[model samples]
Target chain A: MAVYHADALVIRSREYGESDRVLTLFSREMGKIQAVAKGVRKPKSRQRAGAQLFTYGDFLIHKGKSLDTVSQCSPKESFSYLWSDLDRSLAASAMAELLDISTISGQPNAELFTLTLTCLFLLEQYETSLLLSAYALRLMVILGYRPHLGDCVECGERLQGERLFFSSEAGGTLCGRCRESYSGRMVRAGSIAFMRQLIQADLSKLDRLRWAAWMREEVLETLRHYLEHKFERPLKSWRLGNTISDGLERHIRSLNGKEGKEFE
Target chain B: MDFLNYPQPLADLISSLARLPGIGPKTAGRLAFYLLQQPQISQDLAQAILTANHSLKKCSICSNFTDQDPCALCQNPQRDSTELCVVEHPRDVVSLEKTKEFKGRYHVLHGVLSPMEGIGPEQLTINLLLKRLKGVQEVVMALNPTVEGEATALYLARLLKPLGIKVTRIAHGLPVGGDLEYADEVTIARALEGRRQL
Candidate 1:
C-alpha cells in the first residue's frame, strides 16, 4: 500500500463499527477521498480529534485496495468555532455538503480547496447572511456553474430595473420578457444588487457591506431555490441554518416575553 | 458442480449475512458455518426476521416502528402532551425512555438531515412533527451530539418555534460521571458555557 500526505478538510464523518469512523475528505492534493479512521471512537485514540468533520489537517494515509486508512493526522485548522456555535456549524455543514455533492474522487482542484477553507474561516468569523450567500455563489463559480448575475440568462440583454427573475434551470438571471419562457422565482432589485456585489467583492471585505435583513431573506430564498434546482437535491444545511436562526429569534422573543417588553 | 468452490446454500447464507452492517465476508462465512451447526437456531432466526419484517408498521403519530397504529407511548393518555420530545430514531426513544426523566410524547425523525446521503427535511418525519405541534407548548430536541443531529434539532426547532411553541435542545457537553481529564476541549468548553446556577 502506498503512503502519502495531504492537506485535507474532512467534509463528512460517521461512526463505523465499534471504534472506527468512515470519513470523506476533500484534500488539496487529492480532491475527495473516503478513508477509515480506525479506533478513532476511543477516547485515547490519537486520530479522534483530527478525524472530525471540518477539521483541516495534515493527514498521512495508507492507500488500501478498497479505501484509504488514516495512519496519522495532526490538526492544522480545526475551525473549532463552527462546532461551538449552532449557526456557524450549520453554515459549515451546508458548505461541506455542497463540496461533497459537487466533487468526485481523486480530481484535485486547488480553487475548491481554498474556497472551502476560506468559507469555513469566514463563517467562523461572521454570522451575516452575506457570508453564506458569497460562499455558495463563489463555490458555484469555482465549479464553473457561476450564476449569471448582471445580464439576462435567456437573452444577451443587460438586466435593468427592480423586478428580476432567477432561473436555476436557465443558469442565471432572466429579464421581464425572458421570464415568461423560463420558470423561476421572482426576486427584488436589492437581492440582485447584493448578489452582484457578492460576486464582485472579496469574502474578506464582506464585513464592509451594509447588510439588510430583507436582503438576507431574499438572497437566501433565491439561492435556496437555485441550489435545489441545480443540485437536484435539497441542501440540508440551509434548512438547518434557517431553523437555528428562527429558533434563536423565537427564544429571544420568549425571553423578552410580552410582560417583559411592557416593562422596557 | 459448486460455483467458485463453496457449498450450495452456505455461499448464499454468507452472501446474505455479508450485506449486513459491520459484517465482512470472512465474518459472514464464519457465521454461516456456525449457523449450519445449529439448524434449529437458523430456523428460529429466519422465522423471527420474516415475522418482524411482515408485522412492523410505522406508528401514525410518533413514526416509530410499532405493531400498533399510534404505538403504546402515543396511545397512553398519561404521557405529557404539552411538552414533546423530538428524537432522531426510534432507538433513541428507547434510550430516552430508560432514563425515565422525560414524561412527554415523542416524535421520531427516523433520521437526521444528511444531504451527503440525500437525506433532507422532506425525507424525514418532520411534516408529521409540524402537524402534531398544534397543541404542544414545548419541544425538547433530543438528537445525538453529531453534526447532523445538531442540524436536525435546529431545523425542527425553527419549524416548531414559529407555531408559538418553545423549542429547547438537550444540553450538549460532557457525559454524566465522565472525567474532565478525558473529556474533549470542545465538550468541556460547552459545559462551562452552558453551566447553570447551582
Candidate 2:
C-alpha cells in the first residue's frame, strides 16, 4: 500500500459496521478521495476529532486495492463555531451539499477545496447568513453551474431598467422581450442584481455589503432556485428548516390571540 | 472471498465501518488494526460513547441538545418569552444566542416539512409548538433562505395569519459586503420591494 499525505475536507461519512467508517473527502492535492478510517469509532481513537464532518485536516492514507486507508488524521481546522448556531450550521451544510453535487468523485480540483475552506472560514468569522448564501451561489458558479444573473441570456443585451427573468434553462437573465420566448421562471430585477454581485464580489467586498432583511430572503430564494434547477433534488436540510419555521410562526400566532393577521 | 487466515471479527468490523460517512474499507481496516494495538483506547472510546448516548437529551421547550429538559435558554428569565424565533434545528438557537441581536426564546423543529420525502406537519413538533404559543407576541421564521425554507415560511404565514399574531420572515436578497453593480436586477428589485422603513 502506498502512503500519502494531503490536506482534506470531510465531505461526508457513512458507518460501515461496528468500528470502521467510509469517508468521502475533498482534498487540496487530490480532489475527491474515498478512504476508510479503521476503528476510529472505538474509544480513545486519535483520529476521532480529525475525522468529523466539516473537519479540515492533514490526513495520512495508505492506498489499498479498492479504497484508501486513513492511517493518521491531524486536525487543521475543526470549525466548531459553525456548529455553534443553527443558521451557521445550515449555511455550512448548504455549502457542503453544493460541493458534494458540483464535483465528480475522484477528480482532484484544488480550487474547489480552497473555495470550500474559504467559505467555511468566512461563515465562522461573520455572523451574517447572507455571506454564506452568497458563497454557496458563487461555488456553483466556480464549478460551472453559474446561473445567469446579468442581462438576458437569450438576447445578450443589457437588462437595465427592464423586468428581468431568470431562466435556469436559458442559463442567465432574460429581458422582457426575450423572456417571452423562454419558459423559465421570472426573477425580479432586484434578485438578478443581487446574484450578479454575489458572483463578482471578492470576500473582502462581500464582508462590507450592508444587507437588509428582505434582500437576504430574495438572495436565498434565488440561490435555492438555481441549485434546485441544477441538482433536481431538493436539499434535506432545507426542507427541515421550512417545517420548523412554519410551526414556530403558527405557534406564535396562537399565543398572541389575534389569530387573523397575515402571516406571510 | 479469500478466507485463509482471515479473522471473521476483523473482516466484519471493517465492512461495517466502511458504511460510515467518510470511512472506506482501507481506513476501516487500519482503524481496526490500530484498535487491536491499543485496547485502552477502545475501552475509553466505549465509555465516552455510552456516556454521550445516555446523557444527551432534547430540551423540552427548544428541542436543543441538553442534559436538562427545559435547557438553559428556555429556563433563562432574561430571555424574551414573548418573541420567539422558529428555526429548523437546535444549532440555529445557538447561532442566534451569539448574535445578541435577539433576546427572545427559540423553538427547534428537529426537521422540516417535505412532502416528497413524506415528512408532514405531524412528523415534526408542530403540536408541541402550538401548545407553547399561549402568550407569545411574535414568531420569527428563521429558516434558511431556500425554496423549502420559503415554502415553509409561507405555510407558517398562512397558518399564523389566521391566528392574528405578528409573523415575520428573515429577509432574503444580497449580502452585506456584496457589490451593488454586480448584483442581478432581480435581487436589487427584491431588496427594494422588501425594503423596510427606517
Candidate 3:
C-alpha cells in the first residue's frame, strides 16, 4: 500500500466496530475519499482531533485494498467558534449537509472541495442565516443543479424588470406570457435579480450585499424548492434553523418587556 | 502465496482500518503498512484517541461538548440570563452569536422533535430547559424555518404561552442581503406582516 498525504475536510463520520471510525472526507487534491481510522476509539489515538466532524486537516493515509486508512492527521482549521452558538452551528451543519449530498464518494472534484471548505469558513464569519442559503444555492449551481434565473425558458425572451416567474420544471426565468404556459410559482423581480446576483457575485462581496426581509424569504423558499426537487428530500438543517429563529425572537421579546418595566 | 510471509494481525488491521468513515481500501492498506514501518506513530495515534475519548464530555446545560457540567455561556454573569434561546443543536448557538444581535443564554436540544422519526420531547432536552426557565422572561424558539421546525415552534409556543412568557418567532421574510426581484409573494407578504417598527 502506498502512503499519500492530502488536505481534507471531514464531512461526516460513522462508527465502525468497537474501536474504529469511518470518515467521509472531501480532499483538496483527491476530491472525496472515505477512509478508516483504525482503533480511533481507543485511548491515545493520534488522529482523534484531526478526524473530528467539521474539522479541516492535513491527513496522511495509507492505501488499502478497498479503503484508505488515516494514519496521521494535523488540524488546519477547526472553526471552533461555531460551536459556541446554535445558529452558526446549524448553518455550518447545513453547509456540510450540502457538501455531503452534492459530492459523490471517490470522485475527485477539487473545485467542490475548495468551495465547501471556503463556505464553511465564511459561514463561521457571516452573522445572518441568508449567507447559508446563498452558499447552498451557489453550491447547487456549481454542482450543475442550478435553476434558471435568466430569460423565459419557454419563449427565450429576456425577462423585463423584476416581474418574472420561476418554473422548477422549465429550470429558469419565465416572462409573463411564458409564465402562463407553466404552473410554477411567480418570483419577484428583486428576488430574480438577487438569484442572478448570487450566481454571479464573488464570495468576498457577499457580506456587502443588503438583503431585505421579503427577499431573504423568497431566496430561501426558492432554494429550498430547488433543493427538494434536486435531492428529493428537505434539508434537515433548514428545519433546525427555523427553530433557532423562533427561539431567538421569543428571547428578544422577553428582554424587551424587562426593559419596558425599567422605563416605566 | 504472500500469506506465509505476511502476519495475520497486520492484514486484520488493514481490513479494520478500511472500514472506517473515509478510508478507502487502498488507503487502509497503506495505513497498515505504515504502522508496520513506524511503530512510534501508531503509539502517538493511540494516545491522542484515548485523550479525546476520556476527557471530552457534553455540557449539562447546553449539551455542547465541554469539560464542565454547565458551559461558560450558562455560567457567565455578563450574558443576558433572563433570555434563553432554545435551538436544535450546539451549532445553532454559534450562528446566532456571529450575528452579534443576541445576548442571552442558550439550550441545545441535541436534536429536533421529529415525530416521523420517533424523536419527540422526551428524546430532547426539553425538561432540562423547562427547569432553567425560572427567571427567564422569554424563551426564543430559534429553529429552522422548516415543517418540523414550525411544528416544534408551535408546540413550544402553546406550552410556553400559559407560563406568561412572551414567546416570539424570528421574522421570516426577505434576507438582508438578498435581491427583491426573485422573491415569492407568500414570502413577501409574510415578511410584510411580521415587519417590526424599526
lDDT tens digits, residue span A106-190, model 2: 6888777877898788886675466667777767777777776776676678777645677766777777787776667655677
- Top candidate, metric TM-score: 1
Number of clashes recorded per candidate = 0, 91, 110
Q: Which DockQ values do the candidates obtain, in the order shown?
A: 0.14, 0.04, 0.03
lDDT of 3 by residue, B56-118 (tens): 787887777666767778788899988888888777788898998989888888876553233
Q: Residue B50 of model 2: what lDDT? A: 92
Error of 2 at A139 (Å): 1.4
Candidate 2 chain A: worst-modelled 10 consecutive residues by lDDT? A255-264
Docking class of 3: incorrect
Question: What lDDT does candidate 2 reach at residue B75?
Answer: 92
List model 1 lDDT by residue over A171-225, tens digit each.
8888878878778877787788888888788778887887688888888988888
For model 2, how does the per-residue alpha-carbon lDDT over B50-69 read when each residue is reduced to its tens digit?
Answer: 99899989887777788877
**Per-prediction fnat values?**
0.12, 0.01, 0.01
10 residues in a row with least lDDT, candidate 1 chain A: A255-264
